[model samples]
Target: MEKKVQQYYRLKQKQKDIEKELAELRQDILNYCSEQETNETEIGRYKVKLVVQNRKEYDDAKLYETLSDPEVWRLLSKSDPAKVASLTKLNVISEDKIMHTYALKTVTLLQVDKK
Candidate 1:
């Protein structure tokens, strides 16, 4: 009877562990899905452009900088020699770095001068 009770307790403990693991997995999946949704929204609204021929590259730091930097709008407002040079040094825009874009779009917005 003692052996049976020990076995029952062991089974209960095992079940608890499994439940905890399952809950953790579910939370991880939920977090992943939430992150994906946020990324999609950002991609749609963000102004960073991209030009790609083959597989596109993703640069998280650059993206964050571009999105967060206050100078981003100023850069976009002008496409001049000095501005281009400055942005290149800042790595805000690069020929090699392509934003998340579709196949139809090829050219990224380097600068946008007022009309």
Candidate 2:
């Protein structure tokens, strides 16, 4: 058990080291791209593209508020009886119910520095 724990820690540290190196390399690529003022480039067989994209996301707070309204809730319950029935039967909807959705603005740098 002790040996396994030690090995796990060592592996975790090595993973962190590799992640840091990757981040540094990515930063370098970004710096180079900015300096050159180019969005699309080719290095050997790989084509690198940097793009900004707008992703669709649900507003959970607004959704919950909409659901919480008696009129809207009734409409939803009427429209989707099975969904409301299942959630009610499972006893999953409570004051403590925390529904989470990913609401991240992610910038993708594709195919960076590939040969």
Top candidate on TM-score is 2
Root-mean-square deviation of candidate 2: 9.6
Model 1 gets an lDDT of: 0.49
Error of 1 at 49 (Å): 31
Alpha-carbon RMSD to native, per candidate: 19.1, 9.6
TM-score of model 2 vs. true structure:
0.54
lDDT tens digits by residue: candidate 1, 10-90: 999999999999778656644554666532222233432222234323344444454455566455453343554466578
Question: TM-score per candidate, in order?
Answer: 0.32, 0.54
Report how far residue 6 has shifted in candidate 2, in Å: 1.1
C-alpha local distance difference test of each model: 0.49, 0.61
Q: Which stretches of candidate 1 lie over 4 Å from their true place?
A: 38-115
